[model samples]
Target: MQWEIVVGLETHTQLTTESKIFSGASTAFGAEPNAQACAVDLALPGVLPVMNKAAVQRAIQFGLAVGAKVAEHSVFARKNYFYPDLPKGYQISQFEIPVVQGGTVSFLLGDQMKTVRLVRAHLEEDAGKSLHEDFAGQSGIDLNRAGTPLLEIVTEPDMRSAEEAVAYAKTLHTLVTWLGICDGNMQEGSFRCDANVSVRPKGESKLGTRCEIKNLNSFKFLQAAILYEAQRQIEIIEDGGVIKQETRLYDPDRNETRSMRSKEDSEDYRYFPDPDLPPLMISPEWVEQVRSEMPELPGQKQARYTGDLGLSEYDAVTLTASRAMTDYFESALAVAGADKAKPLANWLLGEFSASLNRDDKTPAESPIAPELMAALVKRVVDGTLNNKTAKVVFAALWEGKYSDVDACVKGEGLEQISDSGAVEKMIDDVLAAHPGPVAEYKAGKEASFNFLVGQIMRAARGKANPAQVNEILKAKLS
Candidate 1:
C-alpha cells in the first residue's frame, strides 16, 4: 500500500507600493494598530475604493518576469465572509478573471531542474490582523494592514514531494523579490504560503481528500508542515479512517497541525463583481512600458552565464540565486574582468557565503566591496597572493584597515615570493640544508618531495608560491 504525496502552493506576496491596494492609506509596516487605517481602508460610510495604479503595475511586472499572460481585462469581486479583522465584512479580490495567468516556476532541486505550473495570479486586498497577545481575556483588531495590496499566486498540484514544494516556494520568492514587486520578507508577513496537501495510493488516478495548511511564513516551516501533514493523511488512510478537507495550522512547538475549520470552496464565498469598481482594464502600452523597465531576470541571467560566459550550470544557478547577489558578482566581474567568473563565483559561493552567514549578514551588508573582491580574485589568479595570504588581505578589507588590495598586501606583508630566481635560491638552500630528505626524494621516496617543498616555503617565510616552490624543488631534485 505505497502512498504518494501531492502538493500545491498559494502564496500571498505584499506588493511594494507605498499605499494600500484600493486606498491611499500608507502601507508602511509597524505602525500603531488601527491608526493608519483611513476611511477607505476602514470601510467607513460614503467611502469608495480606488485601485492603486502602482500596485497594478507591480503585478504586471511579475507577470512579465514569469512569462505569464497579463490579462487585458479583469474584475474585482467582493468575497463575502465573516471575520473580526475583515472590516468590510467581505474582501475585494479577483474571482473569475485574474490579472496574470498560466506561468511556470522553475528551480533547481539538488542538480535536477524542477518546475511547478502556476494556475494564475490575482490581485487582492489583505485583511487586517487579529491580535491575541497583550490583552486580558479580550482580542484586538489591528487594521493597519487593511487594504494592503497582495498578489496571490496559485499553482497546480504538480509537486510530488515536500522538497519539490519547498523548492517551488523558494523559486517564487526569488522571482518576486528579483522583480522588485515584493520585499519577500517572511518575517513581516509580506510573503506567506499556504499548501494544499494530500496522499493517495501509488499509481492511483483518483486524487485523495486534500487539506489546506494555512500561513506558513518560513521556508523551513513550509517544508516541515507539508511533511507532517502528508504523514498525517497517510496514517489516517492506512487506519481505515477518512480524510477530511479542512484548514489546519502548524504548531511549530509541537511540530504538528491542528484543524482550524473546514476548508471552503469558491462558491462558499458567494463572490460577485463589485458595482462600484468597473471592469479593470490594461493597455498594451502600459504593459510594454513595464516590460521595457524590467531588468534581466534570473533565468535570462542563468542562460547568459552558462552559454556566453562558459560557467557551469551549477555555478550559474548559484550566482543568480538572488538579484542582489548576482549584482555583486557582476560588479566584481566588471572590475576583475569577465574571465574571472569561475573563481569569482567560487569565492562568492564558498568563503564569502560562509563569512556572510557567520556574521548573520546579507550581500547588501557585506563589508567587502565588489571592487575589493574583484581585486582579491585577480591577485589570487596572478600568483600575487595565494589563498592563505588572500585571507589575510580579506581580513584587512573587512576591517577597513586598507582601502585597496595592494595596500592590504603591503600593510600585512603578504606579497607572494614569485620572483623565479629568488624562489630558485630558496629551493637550493632548502635542498642543501635538508640533505637527508633530499636524498630520500632522489632515492624514489616520493613522499619526501612534499617535505622538501615545505622546507622551501619555511625558508622563504611562507611567502613563496607553493607551485613555484614545487617546480624549483623538482628541478633541483632532478
Candidate 2:
C-alpha cells in the first residue's frame, strides 16, 4: 500500500539573553557543570522564580517578526515531571495560553514555496544536562542549564517529506538568527528540534499515530531521523502491528531512533498555573514599541532587492539568505555606486562566494573587507581593469599581497591598456606578423579575425583592453 509521511517540528530556541529565564544565573555555555547554577536554579528552599524582562522582550520581538498575535495576558504553568536534570521537578512553561499565538513560517522546498502553520511559540525554561560519560556506571547532573530561557516554537503537521522537514528547519533557524532573538547554534544546544513523524495510507484522511523523535540538533540528523521513523511506522502498519505513540532518541551512529518513553499528552504532565507568578501581561503600547523597533524582515529585504534594485528573484533570494550575506552586499553597494548594483551582485554571488567556500570563512570574516571588495569592483566598472585583471587584483587583496586595489593594479602592472594608441600599435604589429591568417581573413575566413585578435592581446602581454584590441584590429583590417 502507498503511504504518506507527515511531520511537525517543535523547536526550542534559546533566547539570546545573558541570564536564565526565571533567575539571574548566567546562561553562558561551557561553564563548569554547576558553577553557573544559582539558588533559584537549584530550586532551593523558600526560593522564588522571577521572570527576565529581556526574555519577554525577545519573545515579543519574535512574535512581531512572525506576524503572530502577542497576547495581552498569558500565564505560566508548572509541568510536573521528575528527572535528575529538572531540579524543580516541575518546569515552568506556558500552557492553555501562550505568548505568541499563531503565525506561518514559509520556506522554499526546491522551487515551490511551502508554508508551515505555527500552532504557538511559548516561553519555557530548559532542563540541565545529564552526564553519563566519563563516570563508572554513575550519572552526573549539571544544573547550569536548568533555568535557561527558551522559546518553544511548535508547528502543525504540514510537511510531507523528509526534505520538506529539513527545509522548514533551516528556514526557522535563519529566521531566529536574523531576528537576533536566538543564536541558532545547534552544536551548543542553542537550537534543538523535536520531530513528530507518522505515516498513513496515501488516501487516508485521519492522521496516524505519531512517534516524537527528540532532540535532533543538526539538519542532517533531523532528515535522517524523520526518514527512519516514517519507514518504521509504515512497516509496522503494513505488518498489521500497531504504531505506538512514544518518544524516541535518534542514534546517528546507527541511523535509527530507539524508543525512549511513552509520549505524554498535556493531561499526563498535570499542568497548572504557577502560584508564584501572576498572569504575564502585555499592553498595546508595548507591542507597538517592539514592532516599531523591529528590523526590516528578510522577505521585505528580498522584495526591495528585486522590485527596486532590479535584481533577479534568484539573486535576491541568494543575497538575503543570511544576515551576513545581505550586510556584505549592502556594505559593498554603499561603497560602490547604486548604478553598479548588477556588477557587484555578479561578483558577490560568483567569485566572492566561491572564494569564501574554498577558504571556509564567512563573508564577514573574509580578509577582503566589503570596502575592498567595492574598490575592486569599482575598478572593473571604471574600466581601470577588465574582468581578468580585476580578479588578479582581488586575489592579491585576499592574500594580503597588496592593501589597496589601485596599488595592487599598479604594483602588478595588471591594468588594462584602454588607450587607443597603445592598442593600435599592438594591433598593427600583430597584423604585420600574422600575414597568413590576415590573408585568410581577406579571403573571407571569419575565424582569422579572432586569431589576429588573440595575437594582438598576446603581443601586448594580455594588458591590452579586449574591446580596444577587437575594435582597432577590425579597423586596421578594413
Candidate 3:
C-alpha cells in the first residue's frame, strides 16, 4: 500500500533582545560556558523572574508583521522537566495563552503558492546546552542559553511533504529575521526546527503516529531528516511493526534519525502558571507603536519589486529573499538609478552573488561598497563594458586586484570596440581569413553571419561590441 507523508514544524527563533528574557544577563553568543547565566537564570532561591519589555515588544512586532492577533493578556507558565541543561528543573513558557495567534506562512513551491497555518507563536525561555564531547564520558551543562528569549512558532500539521515543510520553515526563518525579532542564524543556534513527521495510507482520516526530529539547524538536514523518518515509518508499518511516537535526533553525518526518547504530552511536563510572574499585559498603543516602527515585510517588498518596479517574479523573489539582501539591492539601486534596476538585480543575483559565495564572504563583509557595485552595473548599462568584460572586471574587483571597474577595464585593455571604423576592420580581417562563411552568407545563408561575428569578437579579444560586430559583419558580407 502506498503511504503519504504528513509533517509539521515547531520553529524556535531566539530573539535579539540585548539581554535574556527574565534576567539582566547578556544574550550574546560565543561567550564562555555559563558565564552569561545570572542568578535568575540559574533559578537561585529567593530570586523572582521579571519580564523584559524589549522581548515582549519583539514578539508583538512579529505578530503585527504576520497579520496575527497580539494577545493583550498572556500568562507565563512553568514547564516542569528534569534535564542536565535545565537548571531550574522547569522551563518558563506560555501554555494556555500565547502572545501571538492565527498567522499564515506562505512560500512558493514550484509554480504554486503554499501556505502553512500556524497553531500559535508563544513566548518562552530557552534551556541551556548539555556538552558531552569534551567531558570524556561525563556531561557538562552550559547555562549560557538558559533564560534566552525565544518565540516558539508552531504550525498545524498542514504540510503533506518534506519539501513543503522545508519551504515553510525557510519562509518562517526569513520572516522572523526580516522583522528583526530574531537574528535567524542557524550556525550559532539562534534558529532551530523541530519537525514532526509520519506516514499513513493515502485517503486515511486519522493521522499516523509521528516522531519528532529535534533540533534541525539547517534546511538540508531538516529535509533529509523528515524524509528519512517518514520512510522509516512506512517500512516499519509494511513489515508488520508498530510506529512509535518518540523524539528523535537527526545525525547529519549518518543522514538519519535515531530514537532519543518517547515524545511527551502536555501532562508529562506538568505545566502550571508561574506564581512569581504576574499575568502579562499588552496595550493597544504598544501594538500600534511596534506596527508603526515595522519595516516592509518580504511579501510587501516582493510585490513592490514585481508590480511597481517591473521586476520579474523570480528576480523579485530573489531580491527580497532577506532584509540584508533587499537592503543591498536597494542601496546599489539608489546609487545606480531606477532605470538600471533590472541589470542591477541580475548582477546582484548572478555574478555578484557568485563572487560572494565563491570567496566565502557576506554582503556585510564585502570589500566592494554598494556604490562600487552600482558603478560596475552602470558600466554594463553603457557601452564601455560588455557582459563578458563586465564579469572580468567584477572578478578583478572581487579579488581586490583593482579598486574600481574603470581601473580594471583600463588595466586589462578590455574596452569594447564601439567605433564603427575599428569594428569594420576587425570584421574585414575575419572575412579575409574565412572565405567559406562569406560565400555562404552571400548565397542567402542567414545563420553564417553569427559565425562571422563570433570570429570578429574572438579576433578583437572579446573587446568588440556585439551590436557593432553584428552591424559590421552584415556590412562586410553585403
Candidate 4:
C-alpha cells in the first residue's frame, strides 16, 4: 500500500518594528553584541517591561491581511524555559488566548487552488543568540535579538506532500513580505519554519508518529527535509520498526536528517500568564485603519493580471511572485500598453530575469528602467529590431552605459533589415549557390527549405528579419 505524507508548518516571522517588543531597545540587525540590549532586554533587576505599540499594530495588520479574527483582548503569558540564549528564565508569549485565530491562506498548486487553515498566530518575543566560537572555553551571547517581536503562525496539517508544504511556505513568505510586516529574509532568521511531518497508509484514518524538524531557514531545505523524514518514517514502519516522536535537524551537506532530542509538548514549557505586562486589546477603529492601509495582495493581483490584463495564469503568478517584480511588470506594461502585454511578459520573464540572475541582483536592484524596457519591446513588435538585436540592446541597457533603447540599437547597428528587395536578392543568391539543395527542394525535399533559410540568415549576418526571410525564401524557391 502507498503511504501518504502529512505536513504542518509553524513559521516565526520577526516583525519589522523599530524597537524591541517589550522594551525601548533598538531592534536593528547585525549590531554589536549586547549593544542594542536595554535593561529590560537584559532582564536586569529594577527594570520593568512595556509593550511597544508598533509591534501590536503590526500583529493586527497581519491578522487583517490573513482574514483572521483579531481578538478584542489577548493576554500575555510567560512560557517558562531554561536556555542559554534566553536572558530571562521565561519567554513572553501568548497562551490560553492568541491575538488571531481561525484564518485561511489560499495558494495555487499548478492550476488548482488550495487553502491551508491557520490554527493561530500569536505575538511573542524572540530570544537572543549564543555564539560558541571566538571564545576560549566560553560561549558568547548576543542580546541584540532579545525582546524582538515575532508572530508565531501555526498552520493545520492540511498539506499532503513535500511540494504542497514548500508551496504553502512560499505563499506565506510572499504575503508577509508584500504586506511589509516582515522582510522575509530566511537567511537572516527573520523568517524561520519548524515542520511537523508524519506518514500513514494511503487510506488510513490514524496518523503515525510525527517528527518535528526545526530551524529550516530555506524553502529548498524545508522540502528536502520533509521528504527525507517522511520516507525514513515509512521505511521504519515497513521494517517492523516504529517511528519516534522527536526533534530532528536537517543536514544540507548530506541531504539527510539526524535526531536532535525528544520533542517537547506544550506542558514542557510550563506556561503561565505573565504578571508584568497587561492584556493586549484591539479596538475596531484600529483594525479598520490598518485594513485601509494594506496594499493589493499577491493573490488579488494575480487574478487581475489574468482576468483584466488577459495574461495566462502561469504568467500572472510569475509576475506577481514578488512585490518589486510585480511593480516592474506593471510599470513596463503601462508604457507598452495592453496590446503588447504578451511580448512584454516574455521579455521580462526571459531576458530581464536572466540578466538579473547573471548579475546576482534582484529585480528591485535592476538598473534598467521600465520605460526603456517598454521601448525595446515596442521596437521588436514594430519590426524595428529583431530578437537578436533586441538582446544586444538589452545588454547595453543592463550595463548602464547606454542612455536609451534607441541609442543602444543605433550604436550597436543591430536594426533589423526588413527591405524585402534586399532579402529577396540574398535568398536568390543562396538558392543559386546551392543548386543541388534548391533542386532537392523543387523535388519535394522539405528539409532543404530549412537549409536555404539558414543560408539566407547567415548571408545577412543575422540582421535579416526571420519571418520576412521565410516568406521571401518560400516565394522565391517555389
* Cα lDDT of model 2 by residue, 1-478, tens digit: 8999999999999999999999999999998899999999999999999999999999999888778999999999999999989988999999999999999887767777788999999999999999999899999998889999999999999999999999989888888999999999999999999999988889888999999999999999999999999988888888889998999999999999999999999899999999999999999999899889999888798889888889987788788888999999999999997788889999999999999999999989998999999989898888788877888888889899988999999999987888888788778788888899999999999999999987877777777778777777777788
Rank all candidate structures by their lDDT, best first, as comma-separated numbers.
Answer: 1, 2, 4, 3
Instruction: List candidate 3 stretches off by more than 4 Å.
Output: 441-447, 475-478
Those runs of model 4 whose alpha carbons end farther than 4 Å from true positions after fitting are 442-444
Query: Which candidate tops TM-score?
Result: 1
lDDT of 1 by residue, 253-343 (tens): 9999999999999999999999889988999999999999999989999999999889998998888888889999998999999888888
Per-model TM-score versus the true fold: 0.95, 0.91, 0.95, 0.94
Least accurate 10 contiguous residues by lDDT in model 2: 456-465
**Residue 300, model 2, lDDT:** 90
lDDT of each: 0.91, 0.91, 0.89, 0.90
Model 1 misplaced stretches (Cα beyond 4 Å): 432-448
What digit string (tens of lDDT, one per residue) describes model 4 on residues 1-478? 6999999999999999999999999987888899999999999998888988888888888888788999999999999988888988889999899999879888889888889999999999999999989799899989899999999999999999999999999989998888888999999899999999999999988877899999899999999999999989988999999887999999999999999999888999999988998888888999899888888988888888888878998898888888889999889889999889999999989999988888888887998988888999999999988888788888888888797887888888887889888888888888889999989989999999999888888998888999999887887777
Winner of 2 and 4 under lDDT:
2
Q: List the pairs of residues colliding in candidate 3.
A: none
Model 3, 219-331: lDDT tens digits are 99999999899999988999999988999999989988999999999999999999999999999999888888889889988898888778987888778777778888899
